[model samples]
Target: MKIKEAILGFMREQAYKPMDMQELSKIFDINKEEYKTFKKAIKSMEKEGVIVRNRNDKFGLPERMGLVSGKLQVHSRGYGFLIPDEEERQDVFIPSSFMNGAMNGDKVIAKVLKEDVKGKKCEGEIIRIIDRANKTILGVYEDSKNFGFVVAEDKRIQYDIFIPRQKKGDAKTGDMVIVEITQWPEKKRNPEGEIVDILGKKGEKGIDILAIIKKFALPEEFPDKVEKFAANIEEEISKGEYKRRVDLRDVRMVTIDGEDAKDLDDAVSIERLPNGKYKLGVHIADVTHYVRENNPLDKEALKRATSVYLIDRVIPMLPRKLSNGICSLNPKVDRLTLSCIMTIDGSGKVVDHEIVESVIKTSERMTYTDVTKILRDNDEELIKKYDYLVDDFKAMEELFEILNHKRLQRGAIDFNFEESKIILDELGKPVDIKPYERAVANRIIEEFMLVANETVAEHMFWTKTPFVYRIHEEPNEEKLHHFREFIYNLGYVMKWSNEVHPRALQDILEKVKGKKEETVVSTLLLRSMMQAKYAPQCVGHFGLAARYYCHFTSPIRRYPDLQIHRIIKEFINGGLTEERIKNLTSIVEYSSRQSSEMERIAQEAEREVDDLKKAEYMSERIGEEYEGIISSVTSFGMFVELPNTIEGLVHISDLNGDYFIYDERHLALIGERTKMMYRLGDSVKIKVTKVDIDNREIYFRLTEEDHEDEELEIHDDIKESLKSGIYEEKVMAIETGYHDEVE
Candidate 1:
């Protein structure tokens, strides 16, 4: 281990005590000449918050010193939670006053105000800032007397930036701008900044998305060098090169994607062997062939890591010349790929497999919509239209069933949360929103990809090669226990303590599949599990219940896939020398970390854009009544989710006729006078009352109900709180840190 890691490991000992630099040097057996270097390592550890220095300049682990070092996730209510850096530690609650001057996303060492038993939330106060994440802020500019205020676009950033008038160059009230922070917040004072870039007026056609792009620090365009490199890549392969590769040009394969998909990165082919076994081939776009290691295009792809699919436009990882032109597995064109061909038994076990670099010409470019119509709807016309590839489609369905059954039998917990697709008009305004479903065709592709990923991951693992993996570590025991109790409160039975298998959770999901509470339960269960990420270790994936997994498909869009493709090609071509493997260790580690971080950024950007557009869509329909299910009950009120997957708050004050009291156990609001109650999963009619586009907030009021016949009386206290925006703030607090996506 390096000196830094050694210092941290030593300090993590259960019986280790705080020690000075000289004492630590003695423990490590450092000589006079090595003392300076050893001392520098200790200082570096201190700066990184891996170790805390007490008043006596003695070092120890932060947790041992009653301190938590983590990224502060401040809610819009000004309060925040410390997501601890140390695994197994609980997230510490940090109240606004205890935040000192730290802003959202700042890495800080917080002094523990309270520590208790395992499951309960611990409280803390930020005592020192380790790193600042926000150097600039993006928001709307509101002019003031001598200064302007910029309300941050992210609700999690509670404070409005104070901007000096002279520094607000070319910006006026209601203009969208990016401001560079000149001073960080202290006490009740907001951080001070100067306008850096005046994007445009607030309501412009594309300014909203532009702000989101800049907020995530995403690349607005490719560098000229990267673009030129992509443009110059050869689209054709030499005869000698074709001769060396396992050519599969005669294989009748098809690419299936969404109707509007531009980058076709994967294709599938399958045929039944004479022995009643199935040979499945998953061909992925060989993006690394053109985007070679350390090239401008490769560097740019790694930097971006993943494509950001905003509803308005796509910020692709690679330049269009590669992502859409040569690299895309377009139909009827010879394309290169790294194929995983598996020979599977009737039970979906991969009896044999081969990972090879090959060339192929796609037989057809199909779509999920059309394929679903043929298989699910039994549309004769569509089946006839694709007569040439109908047999392949049937074979795919048969294999999907076998794979799906195998996964379910293995206790894979599948969370089926409905997704919304925001439709935009020509000018980028929200036209409508609809629920996006997972049809048979979509599931087939998903199953195939999952199997291919597992196959490649297992192959790489056995080879003892340096590789990046998609790992989903086991869930926290505390969270699993909490989920068990919560479900039991709803009349379910389960045992939870140290560990619960994925099969137990899968069974519960099956029971609630078609129930009104399915979405809520699924969402909460997903939150209880750990997030999936790219890592260098093969720890296994909890959600998939898989022993091995990796991103082996869609290399055109995901960097991990592209990065691994190069490694796989090297191994297949017999060039993975010991020296080369040593170099690749660092490369794989860096790529894994970068890919995971960038994926998070892209997911957040996409979710924020979707929320913004959804709010815009609802804003145009104020007062329109819609049927919805009460998704959650809180102190403010219950949140209702419409059939199309749009969620809006129904504040307590809006429950007009009778005074209501919240019941935490059952997650319901009961009217005291009339004994009327609305519980989680209860159907209710609501009319859109208000929309806050800047904050992406939607408000609703319950339609006329049984309580309306009783004496009409609104609670004066609730009304007073609503006027002060207390309702929205409390609801937003409940939603903080619990964002979107399951996989």
Candidate 2:
């Protein structure tokens, strides 16, 4: 048995008796020579929360003392929660007073003050900080007379960093800076830090996004050696290399992407089989071919893990020399690819598939707009423009529908939420905002990629290879139960059992289709699902409803895909030697963890940039009224989301009617005296009241003008109906459920 387990067993057997170091040594048969080793083991156990030392210098099991170890997630309001590492455990709420200098993202050991029982929240107090999540913070520097401070851009930090004048470096007032903590906070004091970098002035062009990138510690530029190495790589495929790979240069394939996309990493080709089945080929750019493992370029790509797509720019995983040039599957250029060619039956079942290294030449570059016009709108102009590939496009669309139908039948949950597209001018100022529509063309590509990823992953799995798989575990029971209650209160019934499936949530979403509450419902459901991440273990993806899945496409943009490509090549060349397998076991494990972490950082940075741009866009429309829906309700106020996806808070202070109390059960703000309620999904007219650019926050006020105008319009419609002698007939129709149909 492990030393910690033995210690715990011994303590439990003693029935609440605490043992000192000397006593433990004797009980464990330790001599003087082993005393130091025993003491070290005990100390490690204490730090890990498996055991704890009392004031009397005696050790005991933490479970008996009601202690837990978890990572701390601090809120902007100064309070935090201890999320346990154990998946089954509930989070423990830690009030600010009980924090004891614990910062956000710290791994800490807490003593449970109140145990969670029968739906009650668990409460705890931090007793020890095991590790600090970060040593530096990104914030805006402020100049004082002798000493300055940095106001953290990350609201969860809660405390401004104190920078002594001598430690301020070259940072000026209002400059976005990175601060390295020199000394942690003590009783009622701020943490002392020194400026490490001065990003730029706050309002400068590109500075906002730069600040987010710094905050997430995203690598902005490639190292000199890496760039030089990538530049020296052979741009053209050699004759010898062409002989090694399968030649698919004559295949009629097209790269489908956004109009402005520069990195064309994936292309698709489809044809009808002799047996009336469909042959679909997904060709992904063979980035691993040029960027070998352990090289300078590969190291940088591994560090990035995934490309970050910000509002105005992209921080690519690979440099432009490769990502946009040789590795990009641009039309009329010969490019190497790792292709997944599959033959699908009429029922969308993959009857056979082949994963091969191949050389292909893309025939054309098709944009989502043109494809949508051809397939969805049936525009004759676009159809004729791409006349040569008309039959191929139709075949792809047919296969896409069949695959989509099969996925839906197996309980794949599709959250069709609209994403915001913010347009910026040359000055880097927001010019417009709208929903980025996903047309049928986009879905077709997505479906094809999904199948390809799944096929490659399953193949590697059955081969008993060490590889990274995208895993999304099932949702926590407690969170799901809360979601069930909220949906039930909204008059939607989702069948709940001991285990919840994606289909149950899908059914609820289908019921809410076309309702005013659709977006909010889908958003909440998404929140209830676990985040998908890269892992060495094959934990099935709950969202995709796939038993095996890996990111095998877009090697130029994602490290996991590139890593798998190398593994696939190794498998094809020969078999995995014992030595290679041993090495890959460690490499794949570390890559999976690092890629997941970097991917999260990239996503957060992207969100921060998008939020900043959105706030900037809304700043110009101050005081303008817009129709929106109540997206969320909290103790402070409710957040309203406009049709264009700009969300702003409507503070409770601006309610202007009565003292409102938060109704957590119903997700609303209830007026105490008037019994008025503003609930989630309710349509509300709001005027932009305030915009804090530095904080990237927008505020709104509930307006009565739009509501009054809506009421007047309804009254006029009623009056016109009465004058036309249809009022009685309309009332009769409402009694017959015709009003429901109109709604």
Candidate 3:
């Protein structure tokens, strides 16, 4: 066994009794020659927080030392919270003074200063730093005479990195740069670093997005060899390739996507069977055909894992030559595909299915807008334009409804929150920001892709073949308890037992449909659930309520899908040989973890870009008044989300009628004197008070009328009942979805 594991085992056997170096050395039979190595291992373990020294001057596990080991999440204000790696452990708050030398995102050992008390945060002090999260930080350089500092773009990084004059490199003041840390901060010193590379000037057209790309370490361009390989691949299928695959080029398939989407990785074709069933064909681009295993292109795609969709552009997983060229299921061009053909009955049951490698020719490239106009809106002009495919479109609509109904019946939790769509001009300045509505056409494609993915996953799973599966574990008890309390405060009761099911949450969502708090409730519920990730094991997805799930649809944009495509191709050619299976077992496991981590990085980068652009958009609208709904209420303030989906904070100090007292249980800011309250989902007018471009934050103040309105006051008896916590239980039992119903 490894030294660390051996030490842990020995400690566990000893009932976690404290052991000094000499005792451990004697117990492990360490000779004089090996004692130095043994001591080094113990020190390493201590530094990693795996073992700690107690007041008795003997080492034991952190639990025995009354310490916790977790990753530190630092706030911009310098204080941080240690999120314990243990699932059930509560986060311990670390005050700035107790941080020692640990920085943001450090994995550290902490000693509890104060135990969890009612209505108070658990406090802790960092005792040791185990690991650092980042060695390089992306920021804007501010040059001075003898030295300079780089202020991090990420606000969570509390310290500005100090760069020596000679280490500034080619970067100038106000230039966006990447700084590599040479020395960490001490008691009275900032982090010392040197400029690595200058991205570009701040406020440049594409520089803002580039800064986020650099921050996340997302590769923007493919390597020369990878690009060359992709460019040299034959665009057309050869005669030998055609003979090896099922020829379905004559099949009436159509690629449905947004107009600007170039990576059309999936296409659909549906036929009404004479037996009153539907044959749904989901054809996905077979990217593995040209990008073979262990090739440069394949390696690059594996590293990328997923494409990033920013406000103005996309950093594709594959080169444009493959992603937007050969791999894209373009119209009227012969392309290779792995198709899932399912025979579904009228009730949307997959009676029979076949997964095949085929060559296909897309009949048309249809945009969501055009398809929605033709099918949902029944626009005559669009119907005329696509006269040849109206019946097919109608058939697709029929199957979509049937499939959607089947999914809903299975207790799938669908949180249909509108995404923010920012439109930019040629210069990349935000021209408008609005909610991107999902039309019925989008749902039709989604339903098709989901069924195909599930079918493919089930097929592979039953074969006992190693593969990547999209897994969403059930929410933990603590999160569910908090969610239950939150929803209960809003006058909604969810059926709870020893275990929380998706249906319970789904049912609550149904109850709140069309209510003012629907969006807020949905967002909170989403936050409560665990993130879906690619795993080597099939742990059925909780949100989708699916026993089998995989990303088998978009191979061009997602690496997991591409990796599975390669495995499916190998299986189709022949059952996996022992040699191939052995090789694939490790590959699949590694790919699952790498892809999950990369996907998260891409998502975070995308969100950062979106937030930056949104802040810039709101900056232009400063002083403009807008009607908004209270999305969340905290002790310091309430966050209000406008109709356009731009959220801004309204500070507690701005609620001027009376001193506002925060009620945690009710999720409201209650006025001490007048008994006026501002709760989640309450409508209020707010002016864009200030926009912090650097921090990507918008600050707001309640309109004077909202503060002075006497009609918004609550009765004294109700206030007294709330203060005593007597009304909360009654409110929970009251079946009221509207916020005004409580009043």
- Kindly report which residue pairs in candidate 3 clash with one another: none
**TM-score of model number 1:** 0.91
List ranges where model 3 is wrong by over 4 Å: 1-71, 82-93, 106-131, 713-743
Q: Candidate 3 versus the native: TM-score?
A: 0.89
Model 1 bad stretches (over 4 Å):
9-40, 56-58, 117-119, 495-498, 709-743
1 or 3, greater by TM-score: 1
Give the whole-model CA lDDT for all candidates, comma-separated. Answer: 0.86, 0.85, 0.86
lDDT of 3 by residue, 433-505 (tens): 8999799889999999999999999999998888999999998565577779988766788986777778888
The estimated TM-scores of all candidates read: 0.91, 0.87, 0.89
User: Per-residue error at 711 for model 1, in Å?
Assistant: 15
Candidate 2, 109-215: lDDT as tens digits:
89999886775568889988878876999999999899999999988887889999999988999999999999987558889999999888988888887888888
Candidate 1 colliding pairs: none
Task: Compute the lDDT of residue 19 as modeled in candidate 2.
Answer: 80
Q: Is candidate 1 or candidate 2 better by TM-score?
A: 1
